[model samples]
Structure formats: C-alpha cells, structure tokens
Target: MRVSLILLFVSFRSISGFSQEAEEKKWSSDFSLELEVENQYFSNKGAYANQLQNFLSGAIKPKYNLQSADGKHLFKVELFFRSSLNDPNRTHFDVREAYYRYNKKSWSVSVGFKKVFWGVTESNHLVDVINQADQVESFDGEEKLGQPMVQFNYPTKIGDFEFYYLPAARRRQFPSDKGRYRFPVAIAREDIPFVNDLKEWHPSFAVRWSKSFGNVDTGLSHFYGVSRDPLYLGFNPATGLDLSYPVINQSGLNLQYTKDAWQFKLESIYRTTERQSFVAAVAGFEYTFGNIRSSGVDLGVVSEYLYDSRGLLTFSGLDDDVFIGARIALNDVKSTELLMGGIVDRTKGTQLYRMEGSRRLGEAWKVAVMANLLNEVSPKEILSNFRTDNLIQLRVSRFF
Candidate 1:
C-alpha cells in the first residue's frame, strides 16, 4: 500500500502527461458539504453504566473531486467527522473516499480508499464483505467504513469483471462504556489479536463477474484473505475479552429478477476458515402497487428468510429467521419515502423492529427519522444485550 501511495503521488502530481498533449488540457473541480445533527431517544434504561436515555450527536461530511475534460483521469477525496456529547466511541473520523482513477476505453483502474457494496437482499447482506462495518454509526449495518484497495474493471461482451487488491484492513469499532448497545465487559481496542500473523496489513484479493440477462441480473464473486467478522478469543484477566480476525475464503452469489411490479432477490455465501465452515443466505421478494388510486403513491410489501449453518453458535443470532417489511413512496415534490421492517427468530420468537423515513424540507434541507425496537430477546440469543436498547433517531441535514 505504501508503494502504491508513493507511485500515486508521483504520477498524479504531474498533469502534463495525462493525455496525448494535443487536446486542450482542462481540469475541473467540485466541492460539497453536508452538516448533520441527530438525537437518539431510548425507551428503556441501559443495561450498563453511563448509558443515557437521550444522546445528541453531530457530524460533518465534505467532499472534493477533480477530473479531466476527456474523463480519462479523476481524483476524489471525502472526509467525515462526528462529535458526540455523550459517548466517546461515537466521536470518530473516517476517510471515506480518497482515490484516483484512470479510465480507458475498455478498462479502468482505481487506487486508494473507497467504498464498495454488493448484495441484493433488503434485510441482510451476506455477500457484501469488502468494507468493515462502522458499528458506532448505526446498528443496522447500513453504514460502512471505507477500505483501502486497488480496483481494476474490465468490460467484455459476456460480462463485466472486477478485480480488487485490498490491504490495510480496518478493525471494527465497538461501543465504549458510555455508549449504547454495549457488551457485558469492556473489550480492549489496542493491540488486538489476528491469526496467521498478518494483522491488519494482510493482502487480500477478490474477483467478481456480473451480467444482466433479460429481466434478471447476476453476480458471482470470490474473496480470499482476512475475514471482516471477528471471533471471540477468550477472556483476559485484565482486558476482559477480545476478538480475533482469521483468514478465510468466501464465495458469494447475488441474483435478482424483476418483472413488472415484482422483484425477487437472493444473496448467499459459502465461507471457510481453518477451524470451521458455514453457509449463510438471505432470499426474498418484493411486490409493488404503483399509482394507487391515481394518487402517485407506491406501496411495496417485502418478505425474506435468513439462515446460517452455525446454529446457536452463530454470532449474528440469525440461524433461522424471517424478515417482513413494507415500503411507501409519496411521490411528492418533497421526495418522501418510508420503510418499516422486522426480523423474527423462528426458534426463540424474538424480533427486532425498524422503521426509517426521510423527506426533503426544500432544495437543500432534509429530515430523517428512524426507530429500532426489540421484543422478547432470549438469553441464549446474541441480541439479548440489546433488549433494552430500543431507540429512535431524528436527523436533520443541511447541504451546501
């Protein structure tokens, strides 16, 4: 990664040799900023110390991009910082995207930190494994930390191919003692353990081929190297306990079929490690009722099933579960939308309910609302730690 950075600086520092030198050498830049302030309201008291009922947080995200006239070379940089008045772990910074891309007629190469997503399911993402989860930001796993990698894209008549060389894996952050949805014991963050002596500097590789056939889209991917999910190593006398990131190989498949007002999606993965192997999948379908009563309102119903072969030992506690949800789009000038969903464990009858909605206040202002509720969490389940962590979030964003 260091070598790649050095080469990137040396190559991109000079703009004279980027093109044939005959065309007019032109470069343009764009800058944007978003300011966000949010609050969380918990219905019940926390299970641990320092957990509050109401927490306030704010964040700033700024991005800048530069590109040539012919769109052959491009540069982008984005930064994020959040400050919390209650929890220290919620205050963090991330370099979401700081990458340079060189594009040709048939191929493109990108290097540096960037975000990548891969999955077709609405409830759970079993195939998206490139970036680490930014757990401190959101518990739904929708937010992600940017990953440092070198990506290459090739397009052919059959399919589009992508190759990735990922390095410098980011460790997943946990809530502090003062934060919400915390574990029983505090885990030390410094000097964490990793198998195979690779640590965070392990070099990983991935390849994906995607193609669309008629009304169906498909993607086949394979990843070899470090696993983003951590396994519990054991209790320490001083630090309590820690997690170990092991080396693994995972192959995944994502499929989606769309016909009229119906959509079917599937995402599955087969993963193997030195000690264990397992398969996890999420499959579902969505049906939409468009232009109901000519009111320009669209309503959709969703249902999906989740399964993991690890059973009780599964860290996700989703061994046999089902997700049911609905979506509403107002189709108004304000661009309002709402989504509500719940995941139910078939074995223990526990459930997690979530609802999220957003509406534009005007051209440059927007407001969003989210709520998460837990019900009947069993002690044998992993989500028992969050039984009393049901909370609601309200966020307002100003764009400039």
Candidate 2:
C-alpha cells in the first residue's frame, strides 16, 4: 500500500509538472491545506475514561488536472491526508480521488480510487454501499473510505447507466481501546471474519440506472459483494464479539420528488446473505419554508420512517423507528446552518437525539458543534451498549 501511494504521488507530480512556469498558465495544478481540532466530552462515564479527549488532525488536499488543448482527454488527481491524535487508525492517509478519464459527447470511463454517493435519504442511507464507511472518523457514518474501482457510464434517451468493477475491499476501521465512542467490549480488528477465502481481495460488482423526469428523480441499483455492515455473533468467550462479513446480493431503489416547497424521498433495499434475508427502507419528506418570517433564514421540517425486517438482530439502531428533524439555514454570507433531530425506537421506547450546528469564521476558518443524547435505552436493544457514550463534540477547522 505504501509503495502504491508513493507511485501515485510520483505519477501525479510527473503528469502535472507543477513547476513555477506551470503555475503561470491558465490551467495549472492546485493545492490546499486544512487543519482541524476536535474535542469530545462524554456526559456519562464509560469503561474506558472520563471527561474530555482531544483529536488534532490535518489534511492536505492537492488537485491536478491534465487536459488536452481541445479538452478531449482529461485526467485528474485528488489526494487527502488526515492524521489524528486520539485514534491511531485515524492518523492515516488515503487517496480520495485519482482518476484518468476520456469523455465524449455521451459516455465516459474512469479508473482509479474514488468516492461514489448514491442515496437521497437524510436520516439513513439504505443504498449508498459503493464506498466503505469511515467508521472511526464520525459516528453518523458520513465520512467514507475511498473505493478502488473501474466505472463506466452511458447516457441514454431514457436514463443513465453506470457499471462498476471493484477489485478489493477496504475494511472499516474501529476506535482504539482508549477512544471515547466505542463498543462496550473492544473490537479485535484481526478477529474479523470474511466469507471469502481471498478476504479483502474478493472482487465486487454493481450496476445502477438513474434518470430524472419533471420534478422526480429515481435510481435502481444492484450490488453483489461482501456486506459493508457485518453481522455480529454476540459475545464470544474468547474474542469478545465475533463480527463476520457475509457475502450478499442486494437490490436497492431510491427516489426523490420535488413539488414547490415540498420534497419527498425514499430509499429501500432487499438483501440476501447466506444466513439471512431482509428488507430495509427509509421513507421521508421535507418541507421548506423559504424566507421565514421575511428574514433570510430558511426552515425545513423533515420526517422519516425507518424499518428493518431483522428487528432485534439488526445492527442499525434505527430499526423500527421514526425520525423527525428540523433544519435552519441562515442564507447569510457566513453560510450558517443548524440541524436537530431525533430517532425513536417504537418497540423499545428508546430515543437518540442529535443537534448539530456549523458556521464560518472569517473566510478560511469554520467551527461546528454537535450533541448526542440517548434516553430511555433498553438493555435488549443494541443502543444499550452506548448508553453511557452520549456526548457533546466541538470542532474547529481552518482551510487554506
């Protein structure tokens, strides 16, 4: 991996020719840097530690574009590196997007490591399975690890079709023993089991078709590969909790329709594995009131229903739950935003509430605050393990 990364960087430098002379041109390479500091405090004591922990991280993202004078052949490279103090695995680097492409009037092909987003639901992503979740970076699974694949896209009169060939998989990272947000028992990374004898080398395939008509957009996709969400085999006498990744075949659909101030969204998936077959879905709608109270602020109300057939066996705490949230966006120069939401498990009467806000400071700096509260948790539910992990977090970031 280290050698491949080194080669990727060397190739980028060679292709871009980022000398002083190249910078004088109209289409030269670009680079940027960002630094971030995160502090988290758990409201309740855990088996690990007490009050506060700090994570100082930095990222250097550089982008280079190679284009012919007529713009027929295009190549692009984007790199990202983030290192943190609290989690050892978080202190790592990744190639976010490095691809070479040839674009024509109706079709394109790209080969490299990239990130693909494929879902519309705000509460839970039921169809976004192309990239692995960067579990150690955030609790909400918003961050994703880069995927290495070859992609082909063709636009037809009715819709667009995309096909992918994923050569290998990247295992999700877990927090260290000292990290704050962790399972009750530490996860042994080496103990993770895979159904394939080749393990991470097992290849995966996917195809997606999407299109938009009038105010409605829809997508249908299928994936055959190792499941991104592993199945837990409960507590093991020797390995704590045994987690295994099973090979699965999943078919998914996502749709969004916009009508005036209202937006409707739905994401559903049916997956089958050797041990289990289940259906899961998130259906939601959002209503936005533009220029609320004649002010520049906009308010949005979001409501969603989450369902999973696995019920108690589902790893997602959202099974058989309802989510309601509000979003406030200040259409100011600072681009400030706030989102507050809660997920209530109807069966267990447990709820997880979250509040997040972010605002820009000056031009290059930004700050974000978030809080998570778990209430009325039941021992029979998966969230019971995280009952004591409820916490508030603050992050400051500076961009160059």
Candidate 3:
C-alpha cells in the first residue's frame, strides 16, 4: 500500500507541469460521491440455522478526476466504503480504482490499481482473472478487489496487444459463520499457506491480444503466476485446513459476433497447476426484438451452456448446465430494465432462479431489487451448502 501511494504521488507530480488549467482551477477538480443503502433478507437462517436473516448495510463511493488540457495524461481515483449493521465481516473498504494513464498516438501506459473485466457472456465471466473476488460483498462474484499492477497497451494492424505486471494479489474474502450464505467452515485469514514459493508478493504476468474481424471481436490472453482460484485443503497439519493458492498457467479466449439483433458470445479457459488441470467454457447467444410494434419496448432472450470437466467438484457448481434468461428494456424516460434467469443442471436436477430489476427515480435516485432461489440442491454438488440461503436484496442509491 505504501508503494502504491508513492507511485500515485510521483505520477501526479510528473503531470503537474503540463496542466496549466489545473493551476487556474486551483482545488476545483472534478469530484463526485455516491451514497447507497442496501438490505438483504434471507428466506432461512442458514444450513446450521445460525445466521442472520436480515442484514443492513450502507456504502459511499467518492471519485476524483484530473486530466491534462492536451488529453494526453489522465488520473483518477475511486474509493469504496461499506458498513454492515449485522455482520462484522461484511464491513470493509476498498480502493476500486486509483490509476494514472498516459495515452500516446499508438500506445498507452497505466500504473497503480484498477478493475479489468474481460468477458462477453452474462451467465459467467471465465476470462476475468485480473482481480480477486470480494465474496463478502456479493455472491455472484461481481464484486472485485483491486489489483496493484503496471499495464501496457499497443495497437497494431494485426491486433491490439496488452500486457500486465501484477506486483501482488489480494486474498479472497469469506463471510463468517454468523453471516448468511457462508460455507460449512469459514476461511481463516491469518498465517495462511501457499502451495509453493509463489507467495503473496510473488510477481504475476499476463498478455492479451484483441482485434475485430468483420463482425466478430476476439480476445486471447495468457497468465502465469499465482492463481486467483484457491485450493482449500481440509483442516490438517500441513495446510492448517486453510486457503492455499498454487502457481498456475492459464490461457483464455473470448469471442463475440453481432449480426443485427442477434449476438453470439463464447468464452473458454484452460488452466494447469502442479497437481491438476482442467478446461471450462461458456457459450451463449442473445436475440432481441426491438421497438416492439412502435411501443419502444425491447425484449431479448438469452441462453448459455456452461461446461466444466470437473463436474460437481468445481467451485461454481455449474457443470453441464443451461442458463435461460430474459432481458427487458423499457426505453422510457426513467430507463427501466429487468432481468430474470435460471440455471438447470442436466445431470443432477439442481436449479437456481434469479431476477433483478432497476429503475431511475428522477435524476439523482435509483431503486433496484434482486432475488435468488435455489431448489433441489443435491448433497453431491458443492452448492448444497447454500440450499437454504436463498436471498432477496433491496438497494437504493443517491448520486451527487
């Protein structure tokens, strides 16, 4: 954290010579803050009936931006803070984005920490491994902890190339036993073990190439270093039954083709470790009916097929399953949207139902609703631990 702060200060000072407008504006930088309140209600306490049914939390996000008048240098920082009334593990803070980017004619360089999302499928993001999961924040893995890194990008006729050098990786967060949706055994954060010498400060590297061919957009990338997915060794003398990460090499590909109202997407990854290796893929499509008979309402159908070689042993428990969902866009002034989806296991007869809807209230306020339900979760699958932890989330936000 000290290194990150030093780099940020140095970069900010380097650009001060060119930003004459910044001097004229004095301290009047572009700044904004968003405040949000959320309530999570669980259908049941938990598997052991020792969890909180209702959790209330509030968060604030503040952002600051500075740019040179020539548009060559940009700096931005975003901070996140959350406090929960019920669960202690749910209260945390993160620096989601704090980076300085310099853009030249043919290439760019970015330093510090940021979030990079790289996938086309809605059901899953198999290729997004740059940031670690903030599991205490969300169950779907949408919440990500920032990674400290140095990034480089260069565009060419054949393709656009990007590279990353991650100095350190963050550990995955887990909810406590008193929190809903927790695993049977909560993870211990102190004095954890690593599978090899690739410890927390070990360097990680990744390279990606992306380009468009007609209607298809494709990205191919490779990473070699400490993996984001951890191997949970049971309570024992060697591992102390804690979270241990292994060194790994992963190759990923994401592709999307858009033809009129139809979009076809696919993402796949092949990863190898000292002990094991596997392949996983997600393929899906979305077809939309636009301007439904001049009503300005668009309806879309989404479906995806997820496959994992490990079957029920996989962490996601989405092996050989199908996801079917609908997306509705009201194209109205309030900008209302709704999404509902379900995943069904082909071999185990396990199912998960989910829905989310959000609407803007005037220009400053927004209201959103989300719900998740699990049915017939078999003990053979890993998701059986969350069978009784179905949840509904109500969230409201105000933007300054």
Candidate 4:
C-alpha cells in the first residue's frame, strides 16, 4: 500500500513537469459514483443449503480517471462497498480497480488492478471482465481469489495481446458437516479450509485478437495460468495438500455483424483441464426500428443456447443440463426487456425455466425483476434431490 502511494505521487510529479499548455481544464479528470440494490426471495432456500431468504443486497462504487497533459500517462482508481441484508458474511469494501498506464500509439503497459474486456457487443455484461466470471471457468478450487497485477498490452495490425502476472488464490478441498436435525432430519454444510501461509500467489497470461471488415467484427481470446503454492482455502487446516490441479486454460471465439438496424452476434468458449473440458455458446440477433417509423416504438428479439459437459458438474453438485432461452425488448415502456428460458436435464427428466425483465427508469437508473420455476415432468423422480420449486429476485441500479 505504501509503495503504491509512492508510485502515485512520483507519477503525478513527473506528469506535472511536462510542457504546460496555455490553458488547463478541470474536465481532464472525471469522477462518478453509482449504487445497485437487489430485492429477492427464494422459495427453495432449503434447496440451496439454507441460503439467504427474501433480502436486499446493495453496492456503492466511486471511480476517478486521471490523465497527463501529454497523454503519455493515465491513471484510474475505483472503490467499492457492497453489502447484503441476509448474508452479512458477503459484505466487502475494497479497491476494485487501481492502475497506472504508460501509453504509446501501438502499445501500453499497466501496473495494478485492471479490467480487460473482449468481444464486440452493445451489451457485454457477461463477456466483459475476464478475471471475474463463472466459477467453473475462473477456479481457485478455494474461497476468494483475484484482483490486480502488472499487465502489458500491445496491438498489431492483426490483433491485440495482453499478459498479467497476478497473485492467485490457493485452492482447497471442501469438507461436509452432517448432523441429526429435529427427530430424523439431517443437515449438512460445506466446510472450507483456511491456511496461514497463503499469499497472493496466482499469475495469468491472456491474448486476444480482433479483425473487422465492412460491418462485421470477429475476435478470439485465450488465457492460461498456473496454480501457486501455499494457497489459502476457507478452513483452518489449509496446508499439507498438493496444489496439483491441471494448469487452467481457456479460449474462445466471438463474432458480431451489424448493418443498419439489424445486428447479429455469436460467442463461444472452451474450458480445458487435464482430465476434461467444457463449452458454452450464445447466439443472438436484434433489430431496432421506430420513431422515424412514426409509431414511436421499437422491437427486438434475442435467443441463446447453452450446453454444459457432464464432467463440469461432477464436483460442484450442480446440474448438467441444456438451456435455451429468448428475450423481447420493447422500447415503448421505457426500454423494457423481457427474458424467458429453460434448462432440461436428460438424466433426471427435470426442467427449469426462468423469467426476467428489465426497464430503464431514466438515463442513470434501471430496474430488473426475475422469477424461476422448476419441475420434474418425467418418471416420477424422488424429490429428495430437489430443493425448491420457485425463486424470485428484483434489482435496481444507478450507473454513472
């Protein structure tokens, strides 16, 4: 922390020495703050292993962007405060991003925590932020892991590439705690390991390339990293385990084309380990027309399909199912988008569908709601494996 402050001071001093301009502008620095709130209910809270019930989770974030007059140096910092009403253990306050960059026309180097996003899509909520995504894809095999690091990037005629040397979290094996409940009931909890020697020890490397022609854009990205030693798990006895998981590797391809009011996008990723691999893909399209069309209305449709290899769910106690879903966007009601989707399990004959929608209240705020229903339709399966039949969630966000 002290070193970072020193670096920040030194960088500013160096920037102040550059040739001054005739005029200075306050707008050269930008700052913004935002808040997000979520209200939710879980009918099968029991199914999720006694998780949160109806509750609200919220986060407050502020960010600052600073640039030197010469444009050769740039700095960014963001702080976040998040809390959950039902799950207090999930509360956190930290520096989400803090980085300094040395910039050139074709290349740049950044040191500290940074976010690198790939793909060409109007809304990349899922694809952005490579460091924090799906648990199956971003594994610590442990508890909390991730943050910033020293990263370098270079762009060529063909594509752009980046590398990061980060301190990764250690992976730990989770144990189960079982006990007898009221008269014949059984309750079990996941026991995670916690070790003292654990340090920020994971490092990563990533590369991405994009090419565009006419109205179409396509790109590919790959990331690889190895596990660090003396990793920390959640439980107290975190040592004595060999960090022998396969070196994590992942790669993906994405394509998007837009001509006038119509757009199409496709994205796919393959996650590989020493013993097995998994794949996920989504294809979507949208068409916007209105206002000038005179009716003051716009309409669009989106669809996606997902397939999870059976191996990915083995240790997670999750379902290996195929999912298909679609969404409808209606501009008349303040950019309201409705989503509906379902996942089917081949082995269990169980099916689950989720319904969700979002609407913009203004330029800076939005609200979203979601509901889920799950059922088993085939060979009267035992409910012992089932936890809940429905769930509901509502969220509101203010963005800067």
Which candidate has the top score in lDDT?
Answer: 1
Give the poorly placed runs of model 1, Cα more than 4 Å off.
1-24, 232-242
Misplaced by over 4 Å in model 2 are 2-7, 10-14, 17-28, 48-69
Candidate order by lDDT, highest to lowest? Answer: 1, 3, 2, 4
Return whichever of 1 and 2 wins on TM-score. Answer: 1
Tens digits of per-residue lDDT for model 3 on 1-400? 4655666577567546546767764423588999999999998767764587899999999987887666677788887889999988889888787888889999999998788888889988889989988888998889898788899999999999999999887777777767876666665544345566656888889999999999999999999888886754334665444456788899999999999999999999998887778899999999999999999999999999999886755777887999999999999998999999999999898999999999999999999999999999988877887889899999999999
Q: Model-by-model lDDT, in order?
A: 0.85, 0.81, 0.85, 0.54
Q: If scored against the real structure, what TM-score would every candidate get?
A: 0.93, 0.92, 0.93, 0.67
Tens-digit per-residue lDDT, 34-98, candidate 4: 88887667665444344445656787878877776678777787766667665443355555567
What does the lDDT read for residue 106 in candidate 1?
A: 98
Q: Candidate 2: lDDT over CA atoms?
A: 0.81
Report the backbone clash tally of model 4.
11
Provide the lowest-lDDT 10-residue window in model 2: 18-27
Please report how far candidate 4 places residue 314 from its true position, in Å.
6.7
lDDT of 2 at 385: 73
